[model samples]
Target: MEIDSKDGIERKLNMAQQSDFNDPVISEHNIYVCHVPVNSAFYRVIFPTSKINPYTNKWLKARFKKAVRMLEMRLPQDADSASFDAKKAKYIASQQQSTSKTSFVMDRLLAYEDIFIGQSHSFDAAFEYAISNIYLCPMMGSFEMRHLQAGLQNLQCDEAIHADTDSEFTESESETDDDPSPLRVRFVRPENEFQKKRREESVTLRNKVAEHSSWISLDLEKSTMKSASAKLNSLFSLPNPVDSLLKLRDAEHLVEETIVGNKLAELNLEDRHSLISFKEVRRLPDALQLKALFIKVGVISMQHIEELISFKIEHNLLISRIREYAHLVRGVWVIKSELAFPEDEYSLQRIVRDFALCLLNANLPVRRSDMQLAFGLTVEDFDFSLTTFGEHITSGERTWRLRIDGDETFGKTKEDLRVLIEEKRYWNRRWEEIHHYLSTIKNKSDFTVQKTFKRSFSY
Candidate 1:
């Protein structure tokens, strides 16, 4: 299908007509394809519509390239064909309601947690970590378990002490029934059993440290403890107790790291697959099924949102960014077009930079071609201009590099001009001046008088 260059968006083909195979006649613009009745297309592709700002056409082009790359990668769980099919089916059937490729991928990952979460490949290191770490005491190892048991015992002791104190107070009140003054209460606090146990463990750990002198001391004859009770032997070893402890600690840490690392690797693999799957992704049923799973699991993070939207800048945000670019382009055009013919190249370059980069924060660097495209300028518009914005010396035969002394033509340096432009009050007064001048000219008949007044005003 043809699109008129004049208006880029106008469809030249009849929408009712279809190709011989009954496929929709896909209309191609500069870098995007728009299928008629987009929702039912093989894959829903976002195209630049009349509603989208012209300045954002570049962004759409970039998104199209990213989406294509996403369509090329393979899924992570390619081997488990049966399981994959079953999971997909269950996801589809269970949805009365629910959403997106990203959501589907995340749900599958959650369901198959064993692939990413359970076992550590580095068993020796992880086991060593578990045995030695003080923090892992509550969860594992003989010494740490003993410490936890002691803590519980301490809690029980505190409750018993409170009960005894209450009983004594009751007895004393009964013996002196008529005494109105509150009975002086002084009960000795017991030594904390948890602290005592901790101190004992600390002393033992310190004593073990003394035996080793260094943390890296390993038993050279590893064959001595090669039994099912190897772990028990490590716990009771007198010399270099810390070595055994550190190994246990390392094992525990390794387990945790392995779980997290494996999960991340699988997730990354799946995410890559999701990108590829985007090409054939069917909406409605599949999206709804995934959404349902996400809702069921209450997975409502920004990452989930990003996954759903394919991490492209959202429409509103894109429009906002584009609007800033367009405004800068418009402001520059307005300022330049009103100036006298044969303005200095340095001044134009400075003004364009100040308008486009400093104020707008353009996503891409401002270039001559971009500036031309932004305003749809023709060769005639630049007839009197020396360069796209200003003159710059050509580097070798290939590149245009601005010379150090390129701005010698201007009264002020680029930095000085930028500072002046950045002042809010300066722009406000300029805006008011322009407003007053524009307010005076109601029709073409007033232009002659207005031009005279404007020349005198010297803006």
Candidate 2:
């Protein structure tokens, strides 16, 4: 076959087309071979259109025309079998070496065609042309190729079955769309005996707390309240003992006042003053104490001091332990200082900013009142100072926290503050536990003494 000439190429193509059905290869498997010269232009035209279809004795066609167009673009004039084999080996090795299951499955699926369309007219050229394109799978051994094809067929069958089931379900859902009633399933676990009892006790405790708010302090521990309520219920055999406890508390208060009065009369002036100071400080609430401290030291505005110290007192409640020369404002005592305020507005603003930052860095929320007390700033001056450093802080409901975004310094400081706060909380919890244990022990000791005294009297 002189394939160099156009006439000879045409003759070769015609022979391939005429023997398409009669040839053993074409009859059995629709395999058509069209021999063409290496440099012939007719090779491209003959290769794609000359192949016979297996099911129908017609021209073979590509399922994806886009893929065929791309393949045409990549087709090389001269094929290199060595280069093609090397590339194929590399591809197979990559598929085998893949660690990801998804990639391996995809690679296997790509290794063979689902439908057999016989061999390509130019195997080396086709392989070389599509080697770099990942969408195209390289040819594999006959046995592996056959296995992949079978697997693909099974997969297709499963998918078709699943698609039919889905269609049926969708149709049923459309039918139900018109119905007003909806079906719902709720999964619940029935409570056991212990859970039921616990739930009932919780309800009872809540009811008692709601009914008798005056009998017990709201700040009392939940466990302590529970135990006290249980004891009261068991001892008196009453559903509610709050009224009895309230009357007992009033009587105890009277007796305590009488004893304190007698002790005050017996003590000397210095000791009496000390006793009175201790009692006054103990009686003062935390909010009142903070106000007294601010007022006495003149940390707040002078205008606000008089209004803050509303409580009438005959003498100052001096706490010498807090400060040696603490000021006495009305009845409240606070730290005395001859400290000078900064004359410059900039300096005063700087002080407020520094203090606020320190609080934020410690993971403590900044309150306006605390800032005013710390810096001796009036409402106007405090607001002005806050406005000056507004970008660094974010406001909460009644407090402020550091805004760490975009600022490296604040970000690192916040992280460190978080760790410090966590450690402090851990220690605080430990201290609370120890205090609770000591309180329990003291209570047990007092009960034992009372029991012993009663037994002695009975004997």
Candidate 3:
């Protein structure tokens, strides 16, 4: 096979002639880059695969040669095949586990198996792993819990596999179709207590989600016409709005296929990349539509939020400040309305009572940005130094009182946020001031100022 390196191309070289290649092309035009780690005794050579002995035979032995010059060769002349395979295996094992949980795995579990079965087995496993490995592991009390029904189903599958294997090896039974071969073996139901409990839990949970889901649907449809205009602006939009929507609608069906090769190449997920790139990924309809739906889904269910609840929200804007995080709530339902209520949101009972009032006033289908208006906040009117807005969190409750200095323990939340939505009033501002000084820049564009910001979402 011909070879190429970062240095230059080398033609028709056998494995030994080329000692090492930072990059090499092997038999069938596969190309690889080898990296020799700093402060290490050995190095790795990578190359394209060969049809006949693509990655096989003498090609690998050449990889074993320690010296730099000999390592560059395409093939090694004297090495035995067995030794190369063993070393190659050793080398490969040193690599971090790169085997992906395949789309096949997700497909086999979700599509091939029963719906609940996949969620119970693979879905839960992946979810648990993500929580434990990525998030919750350090906490002392954290423990992984399994759904009892899922556990039982898995236990049953294992037993079935064993029974089938044993029946095949049976000496006495000779299968004959005429008499139906004695039909079958006795079935033993799973006896595990956890399994029984999980099964019952699964049925209960399914019913709950189904009931809630139905309620959500009915509510959203009722509100759709009223709120449809605001929601659709974000949903049906196209960079080239006329053509992009049709392309996006087709994308919903190909989620799995579209995400495969293009995942990390995705600029939006990595914040270090320019925000312009973030806008580009949003052009993908699956992500944009999903986000649009999710935001609306919560709007439809706002009544479900209890007045004294605090919801950690999405739509956070990250500016330069080290610890400051900003969240924008598009719409929230107010439980009650009053001509005049307490000026602050600090009191537990008061914030819920007041915020609920605002929700009631917002009418159906509040613009997410409009939710800020429900609070009746102004930077000039409110004192922000003391409480900053924490008192406004309903904690676990939905209604929160924005804290004023009088109830100084709680802080100005919606009040502080008012600065964001108020149309920029400083007439004296320079072009550079808008460009750099506005740390939380969302609503500006050279051609047409982007009126709003959208978060790319995936569930």
Candidate 4:
């Protein structure tokens, strides 16, 4: 095996030379072994020999010798030897068994295993011993909470006495109170001198921040100063004449423009007219005035007029004049002329047809009852209107929808329509069979036919 040092130096060592070095009692040197290649004779070692103590140098040399010996022993003379293969398999099995055993022990320790220390009888004593052992070494600094918890649970307190007396506890009390107290496990260790000094410095910084916050609050309440300028003044406590001149020059454009651009594209003519009228009035009319206007119009309800007055007062805008000409009747708004029917029957029928068509155009599949109420038509008049618009509309089970081409598909594709038609044909064939059965059994009572029909329906 070859050893490479940090000072760009390399040295080769044979088995005899490697075995010559003695093991050291105390070593501080860091050594690393490179990965071994499959079926290789020798391995590589990377070690830094420069500035290393005599003990570390001796320790590294001993480690290298041991590694070389292990590699040489594991190396087989022949590649296809059955004995070597068996040895390799045995070694692998032994390693796996060791790993599984270590894991099992770790799981047991993490659960509730008995941990005993020399002359220690209580969990607290055992835990303290473990903690002291960890910190006793100068090299060890801290331990984790999980490790502490597992250790505490695994601690054996078989010889523990009651806290109130020196007498040994009974078996039941020992069993019930054997578990360690989680309250005793602290995440943070006690602060040392250095940490105490840092904490004091942090307190001073916190006080300064609090003082600055108070100053900021006082400044906000008492001063009308601009934020950027106030911050700059607070930081520097001086103003530059050249910077002031530049700021004044920039402030010249800060004045708002007097002549606003036209917004004709955004506002329609009717809206523009309303805006102009509102601008001329500059105020909303009184509620009594609005109520009188609504009464004269004879359309809006008293509550609706109050709502409109409130809206106008909030927005300070005039209501549109288009709706003033219409009158509300049965929750629907209609023109004044539409309230009266024509004296001639033909003209009245035409009006009803036109009204029904308008309703159908707005919302498809208008119900017949809704049409009658909306058009103020009797059954005869509604039938006549339907005849008039027969070509344009079709009747459903209880509603009327406009007759559009391909509407039988009901917004479905050709494939979906085909499936629907097949289902319809199946039902139609069953109905035909029922009809033929009924015809053949005409000599029987009507009750028999009804019973057969009900049975077929159930089937």
Whose lDDT is greatest here? Answer: 2
Report the lDDT tens digits of candidate 1 across residue range 200-264: 99989865655454222112222334652564344333334566466565554444443423233
- Poorly placed runs, candidate 1 (over 4 Å): 1-144, 149-459
Per-residue lDDT over 1-459 for candidate 2, one digit per residue giving the tens place of the 0 to 100 score: 212232224322334456454553332212222232222222122223322322231222232121111111111111233223322233334444535455754554433222222212233332212232222113221110111222222222245544554554445335445444777745498778998899899989866654454221122223347875664244323223576565555653454444434444454322211333333332355334433333223233223333434344322232222233222221222223221222353665645654554444345767788767545578787765554223323344577542212122311355434533553454355446545654676688889999999999999
Best by TM-score: 3
Ranking by TM-score: 3, 2, 1, 4
Once superposed on the true structure, which residue ranges of model 2 sit more than 4 Å away at CA?
1-319, 322-379, 382-459
TM-score of each: 0.14, 0.15, 0.16, 0.14
| Ranked candidates (lDDT, high to low) | 2, 4, 1, 3
Total residue pair clashes for candidate 3: 42
Off by over 4 Å in 3: 1-52, 57-251, 260-297, 301-459
Please state the error at residue 232 of candidate 1 in Å: 16
Any idea what lDDT model 3 has? 0.30
RMSD of candidates 1 onward, in order: 33.4, 38.3, 27.6, 32.5
